[model samples]
Target chain A: AQSVAQPEDQVNVAEGNPLTVKCTYSVSGNPYLFWYVQYPNRGLQFLLKYITGDNLVKGSYGFEAEFNKSQTSFHLKKPSALVSDSALYFCAVTHGSSNTGKLIFGQGTTLQVKP
Target chain B: GAGVSQTPSNKVTEKGKYVELRCDPISGHTALYWYRQSLGQGPEFLIYFQGTGAADDSGLPNDRFFAVRPEGSVSTLKIQRTERGDSAVYLCASSFGPGWEQYFGPGTRLTVT
Candidate 1:
């Protein structure tokens, strides 16, 4: 019962364009993805993780994410966008048999970068 | 070098009174976490400490909630009676052990009026 589905609550890009923040997961066996970022008041900030081979995961300021094992999805990318890169965006999951890192979050996505 | 740290960043309780929240990990980080955020939603774990015990508290939500880390690097989260849905924003994380990669703290905005 590891779930995470951030079906967009807000997303509007423009600055340099190219931005997408969406994720999905259900986990049962292989899944250990994560991407976090929060700004207004600050807290979370660890923008990358996919554990195992790299399904195109690159993180930090420039951001990047793509691990679509048959579309179990894990999208969070940015090719340009900047307006300080907006904020709030989280998508987590833990499985792969569990080592008890325990994380299963979602329901957060508000990346408004317009300038 | 001094990452996770949470204290009375902001707290205004009153519902039924009785609150205490504090966390200070990341000195060696043996794993310690507690989450609960709700104002847009995201963080929500509740408990997990691995140096002083409490392997997991099953996302505490009842029994007046409680937590402690004794001498494993500071950790305390005790709430009793307090309601108003227990006002959100109370997070603390640390890791370097069990699964790894977790370091957050800048939370503790419980406001139950």
Candidate 2:
């Protein structure tokens, strides 16, 4: 079974400061990891993903994630946080076996970027 | 050109009532998915469809929830005897195919009173 965990319920960061939203996963096969953001009353928007290749992957809106194989982690990072970046973040994982393509999501972490 | 869209931005119904949520995926997207998001929680996978047939329905909470994706472009999620626990934002997404990046709809907020 593929599963994801976001240990922190919330992360507070200041505007213009670096922000990191941590995520870890457990999967039997090759993991297809993803990061998504949800604004108030809106459906989640994709941020980035790690399928294969380089450890550092860049995504939309200046967001990026590093896939650490040994740690089994894919942590999202932004060089400078913005107030508009305040929202809920989710980490998801799916196994690369059969292409049913179902994503198992983490509990979610609320990011608050203070201005 | 248009993104995935869901109808009835908000729906409030009494418990035990039946409700239907609609979704319209992008013009060429062949894969569609339905998920439920409760307050302060990440979206939970509910069902997924490839073309006109449901590829997977294992994530559905129970038999009371049924979905159809006839014609392969639009999908509908029907909930029977809705309960308060069912209240949440129902999100719809579509992708080019299996294992592809999914584009999400605005979502429909369901409130079971």
Give the interface RMSD values of the models in order: 9.6, 1.1
Give every collision pair in model 2: none
* lDDT tens digits by residue: candidate 1, A1-115: 7899999898999999899999999988888898999999989988888878969989888899999899899999989999998989999888866766878899899999989
- What level of docking quality does candidate 1 show? acceptable
Best by TM-score: 2
Cα-based lDDT at residue A105, candidate 1: 90
Q: Model 1: residues >4 Å from true position, as ranges? A: A1-14, A19-30, A34-64, A67-75, A79-87, A99-112, B1-13, B17-35, B38-42, B47-57, B66-80, B83-86, B89-110
Query: What residue pairs are clashing in model 1?
Result: none
* Cα deviation of A46, candidate 2, in Å: 0.8
* C-alpha TM-score for every candidate: 0.34, 0.97
Best by DockQ: 2
| lDDT of each candidate versus the true structure | 0.89, 0.92
List, residue by residue over A1-115, the lDDT tens digit for candidate 2.
6789999999999999999999999999788889999888677899998888999999999999999989999999999999999999999988867487788899999999999
Stretches of candidate 2 exceeding 4 Å from the true structure: none
What's model 1's TM-score?
0.34
Tens-digit lDDT track for model 2 on B54-81?
Answer: 9899989999999998899889999999
| Residue B107, model 2: Cα distance from true site in angstroms | 1.0
